[model samples]
Target: MMRAELAQNFRQLELKKKLEPMLPVLDFIAWSLLKHNQDVVSQLWVLSKQQSWRTSKSIPNSLWNWICSAVDEVTLDPMTKHAWLLLSDD
Candidate 1:
């Protein structure tokens, strides 16, 4: 059991390492989609998961949801929207 657990942990770590490089690109795509169409947030999440991006385990997923929910809940000015895009870029 210990050996299995250790193997799983190592696999997860390897996956994370592979994913690290793609994170910025994914974030940029998600942010750009959100800026134009709020309705596509769920689709973005689904696509991310489908691509094996581990959306639930990543910061970009949470950030995307938060920004989309905020936009849905309250009207953000253009400046605020741009700020979010800039922040997500980092």
Candidate 2:
């Protein structure tokens, strides 16, 4: 159910051209992590380290707010707390 929802969200972002080319890959990583496919998730993380893009300002500010809200949600998850911590440390 969660994977489907995430995939739907990804599809919308892709259609809007609001996501990077690596986003589908990132979506896979997120879905895999949530599904306990750590090996695949780790591999995606490593691959992401090699990618770069020009950050754009045209993205809606509401999207940034939504990201913050999502991060807040993730922070409440025990399994995802580490990711939140790493984000905070940065």
TM-score of each: 0.38, 0.23
List the pairs of residues colliding in candidate 2: none
The local lDDT score (0 to 100) that residue 38 gets in candidate 1 is 52
The local distance difference test score of each candidate is 0.67, 0.53
User: Per-residue alpha-carbon lDDT of model 2 for 6-90, expressed as tens digits?
Assistant: 9999899787675555555555556545546545644554465446454433433433343355444333444656654544332
TM-score for candidate 1, please give it: 0.38
Clashes of 2: 0
Which pairs clash inside model 1? none
lDDT of 1 by residue, 1-90 (tens): 799999999999999999878876776676666766755865775576789834456456555565557654544455657644543322
